[model samples]
Target: MSRTLQSGYHRPRMLRHVGRFSPVRIQSMHYQSGRHIRLLLQPGRSLYDALVRPLQAIGVTSASTTILGGHFDHLEYCVAPPDPSGKAVIAYSSPIDAGASFMVFGNATLGKDMEGRPLVHCHASVRVEDGSVKGGHIVPQASIIGATPISVLVTALEGFELRQAFDDETNIPLLKPFKES
Candidate 1:
């Protein structure tokens, strides 16, 4: 904890994870020149499909995306809190239904899962119908887009693939870039 001498205010320390720390903290990859796409997320489609299908058609399977603000018919998200079990440092909580929410801003990553399926990892700040603002990991498959199209900026990763692999330190499947075999 840290204390302010004059004000006598004590600040709690940041929580540490229970798992063994990995030597490689940031597993990132870069490309020579990213292919940028200004995509308009089609209405009436799940966020997952809206992102995956069109990009797949363009041969872009790996990329980082920024989802601009837009409305959703329904939305569900999960927050990461301390794991109740001692298996990992943190775990995603059960999905929280944010009914008829407006996504204020979001960043999403596109990669291939262990089974070679498209996986979208998205986090967003949203405004619910009740006017409360919240943020968490967005469930793209469950969140349906509203009538209007949502704008997204996509930076396609090429020359290498983003694949999910098991990480020993975190004991989780994480997306990492790998050169084409």
Candidate 2:
């Protein structure tokens, strides 16, 4: 009868996920050393090709990149909202175009997709054609680099690689740090 009713009220414990519980959390890896690269995104090429091809040539299979501000002939991005069907935690919305845009800054994690192909997961803030600023996940393959080249700082994860693994906690295939294959 001495319980303090004012400060700590009795509340039911709740579980977050719609699916069953997962035992594992925070799967991570470490590398002896990391490689760094200064990449110039080629002009007149898609953001995807500009970033991917050059890195591929140098045997850089996995990396985390920081893209500095630059111009884009055209750009597109998508936002992630709650999943309506309860199948996944969230889903990407339809592409929103920003014609003739200027990229402000970006964080991109590169890894292999489920099909074992290179994938770039990029998110950025940009100044659109209308002079408005916005931020979201970029559709790199569709985004065309402008006349001037863009610079990117690449932190290549060596000894281990990054690949998309199904995350039960989030119910999504997200890029995760993994051992080199």
The candidate maximizing lDDT is 1
**Across residues 13-64, which tens digit of lDDT does each residue of candidate 1 receive?**
7645545667877766677888999999999999999999999999989999
- Which pairs of residues collide in candidate 1? none
Q: Give the range where candidate 1 is weakest over 10 consecutive residues by summed lDDT.
A: 12-21
lDDT of 2: 0.90
lDDT of 2 by residue, 93-181 (tens): 99999999999999988889989999999999999999999999999999999999999999998888899987776687888887777
Model 1: residue 150 alpha-carbon error in angstroms: 0.3
| C-alpha local distance difference test of each model | 0.91, 0.90
Residue-level lDDT for 152 in candidate 2: 99
Mind sharing the TM-score for model 2? 0.88
